[model samples]
Target: MTVLDALPSVEHAAVLDESSKREIRRAILTAIAVPGYQVPFGSREMPVARGWGSGGLQLTLAIVGPDDVVKVYDQGEDGGVNAANLRRLIRRSEGVETTTDPRQATVIQTRHRVPEDELRADQTLVLQVPVPEPLRGVERDMNELRRMHAEGDYSKMWVSLYEDLVRNGVITETTGYPCLVGGRYVIATTPIPRWDVPPLHQAAFLSLFSAGREKRIYAIPPYTDVEPLTFEDVPFEVEKVSARCRCGLVVPDGDLQSYQVEIPQQDGSSVWACSDTDWCTRQRVEAGLLDPSAITETEVDL
Candidate 1:
């Protein structure tokens, strides 16, 4: 039996036909050519349901090859149900190798988080987006939304944000914050936390966003400007993790703060742990701080 026939139904669905790959590639090229612009395309069949990262899977399948190393993560976890299943599908369907390490992956498909590591120039980060429209909150009418986007009229969005600031004392949005890419086109930053948002601004790797249900694809090319929509007085800030990690590491500024997760303790209180388990283990290994298993004689440089 062939690889396609041997696998289960879900994996079988992801093994896209050649025509679908070509159409996805065409959409990708168009998206890259016009940064932050949501280019519409025909959403093809994939294993996952509409809102469950089918778009990202399709994009990865179109470009990933046998030699490529793929990684899929859901909220920074490599072993989560979603991540594990998707990674298995990609590997089994295409015969491409898979890795949990961000450093080793050529294309990293993510559900709602970006890797904490500084992505290399050669890598491509594909973010799965449930909602691709940044202005949807401000404008409900599709025709009017298109017209506003075409005319670059974001006055209502600015007003809405101002109202949010007035009522909440801060921009209350925790994820899917809107951002201006390439100094034009205010695009939704795909449910990534405020912490993950900064790396996308002037980063080394290219970022692709796909919405399977929405049938749209968009991109932020390498080294492009990505500015969060905020007031001059109210500068954008990431959520802070104040507690020390059980790994004997203190919360370091300017690096992967969003990767921190709160762990409940024996008491009613809780502590913080780095959600990027690989990075945390590496830190422990390198420092010789606590865990010996995570520590090896030689370490791989991130």
Candidate 2:
């Protein structure tokens, strides 16, 4: 084939070829068929760097169509640098409509946090995963880890949590809590804080996770079971925040101050304003704090 036929045209940089997308779609279907099972795929390198969400972009490219509306978020904000760049890239390639509103999106690609709004049954969520294996820290070797997964040998994982409970008086596996999926494989959601984990349990929308660097993809279908590992007596608990947002939204307040103190904001304020930029802004408008027309990307800094 000629060079022109081999590579994608600059005009169509956002969308992959039909055959390539079909392969990814097939892999995604297989993953969905077998919930919590990590299916390996031929992860392509995108223009963006590896750590900046190449996997989630690939899934978006494969599933996104001209008619579908997409929303991209990093740490619950779509206006952030990473999310904006990815959204631009996707738009450039597919010429698809994009939105900050979660309710309007057909597909939502997110890193580190799920949207604060309840996702509908028809919506699809693509999660960018840094590490898909829940047993990675416990067993470094891939072969041994696979063997452990096959044998359901998660004793090491359980022991670690038990130790944490013994020392801290609570299971301190806060974010990326190792969860048992479909009562089978143990999979950890990528560093999404504990507050977001509960939404995954029997969620209405289909949740798909892709780790591009790791070359693994997994899915949790709508209505699937996702239970965080914890003893019956010592039940799992989410991180609690002390205060509500000024707009009357239940947001992380004092506890978040500890973690967000290091992040320098554009206005020199702390990053504890709102985790979900769109949600917070909507709440503000609903509360008549700001006019709908005044809402802009820069107004709310996540």
Candidate 3:
């Protein structure tokens, strides 16, 4: 029996038809050919809710093959409800191997956070985007925004950013900042935190951003320039956290600082632990930090 036939009815609903898959694949090929150009596609309705990462899910289904190892993350946590649910859906429908480790995966479909580990050349990052249009904030009309992108008219966006820097001494836009890709079209990346922005600049892996709600898909080809919109005098800055958790995870370039925990009645004390579940688990295994006997059955599912 085929992979889809093996899944139960509820899980099978996640699978898109062959025609839809073909169309998505064609769009992806076109996106890769014209890097950074936002290619419109007929986004298929997913089993999941529209705003809840259906775009990333669709991309995952389209690119995933029987031999590929998939990884899904929601805000850097792979074991979270959203991530786990998507993982199960893909596994059930495609019956492909899945992984929590970024290095092991061929395709990683993520929401709002890239992994701390740098992805390999063979990996693909599928980012779920809420609004694909970078000019949505400046120009309300979609047609006008398309025209602005087509004509390379981004003076208004640059002016607003200049005004913001003058007023606040920094760019006010925090997440999903506009970026010029391959020195041509400006595209809005997924609403990832500023900390993840630098990784997009000539990244090793191919990056794909899909917006199911907006019905748009774009790509940043491997080794392509992805410069965040900024002035030369005042460069873009990523947020740096120095708080050292008791878990012994060290930031190579970050300074060591105390991490405090809130308690009911006792005084707060410094401790260190990883906020990223997958990274923490990987580290624990590598460092022999975790007890193998304590590993539960659920933990072995991945």
Candidate 4:
């Protein structure tokens, strides 16, 4: 059956709160006008905790409609505890349809990892960024940081990287790679894997980033320039897994495959997939893609 057919009916009174919608609409409009600029907004308290995917949840509530199909992922896979919690929150609040198929989704909210495939121009990818500043660590004072960004001063960042090279031989930074957007604005590309970074540069889709605790919103419109910060000798590199997904599945254009693994403990093991739980469950039920019950607590190692 189609995604819409699988979803439950929406209750107009319960779907949206007036204040939240207004705030999001304003933020989105400001994002469109400012392009690479990061705009601050009044983020609301979500049922989910602050560090979780609350930012994405707020955006989903703001943009999702009765007809839109929503898909959420964390760390490339589906059906994890956190992903499932976020899905339950959205489903309870809005009663909208959810899926794992990137091509089938009108909106996608992700954390830490982007899908293994490429997204289209029409779809919107909302990223949950823990930090939004590329120069935050370099300049602790917000006032000074703002001035540096305003004046396009990034010498300190270069100096810092040089220091890292001298001390550690390599940058040593693993997550939250920073990038220069539109050639003028420096922004954090979030904590997504480095493999997902290049696909974001000059992509067809509009990429929106929101940090709830930070109360910041930023965007990279379709075809906008996004370049990673790097020296001429040291080029930017994406992180790659030495092994392919053990599932032996190839992701389609704008889609990804799910894998089940067991995390070992002192006594027993916990078997679960990396994809969002809601996505995996739906896929299993609808397409016979994965068997949830087959995942035992003694077979996988994280």
Worst 10 residues of 4 by lDDT: 245-254
Measured with C-alpha atoms, the lDDT of residue 202 in candidate 4 is 87
Instruction: Give RMSD (Å) of candidate 2 vs. truth.
Output: 4.9
Pick the winner on lDDT between candidates 2 and 4: 2
Query: Candidate 1's error at 288, in angstroms?
Result: 2.1
Off by over 4 Å in 3: 1-14, 251-275, 296-302
Q: For model 1, how does the per-residue alpha-carbon lDDT over 101-157 read when each residue is reduced to its tens digit?
A: 899999999977888889999999999999999889888999999998888899988
The lDDT leader among the candidates is 1
Expressed as tens digits, the lDDT of each residue in 51-127 for candidate 2 is 78989999999998889999999987788888988887777677788889999999999998888788999999999
Model 3 lDDT per residue over 227-283, tens place: 999888887887655554455655435542221221233456544455456776666
Model 2 misplaced stretches (Cα beyond 4 Å): 1-15, 246-248, 251-271, 297-302
lDDT order of candidates, best first?
Answer: 1, 2, 3, 4
- Give the C-alpha miss distance for residue 70 in model 1, angstroms: 0.6
Decreasing TM-score order of the candidates: 1, 2, 3, 4
TM-score of each: 0.89, 0.88, 0.87, 0.79
Model 2 residue 61 CA deviation (Å) reads 0.4
- In order of listing, the candidates' clash counts read 0, 1, 5, 15
Candidate 3 lDDT (Cα, 0 to 1): 0.80
Displacement of the residue 286 alpha carbon in candidate 3, Å: 3.6
**Residue 93: error of model 4 in Å?**
2.1
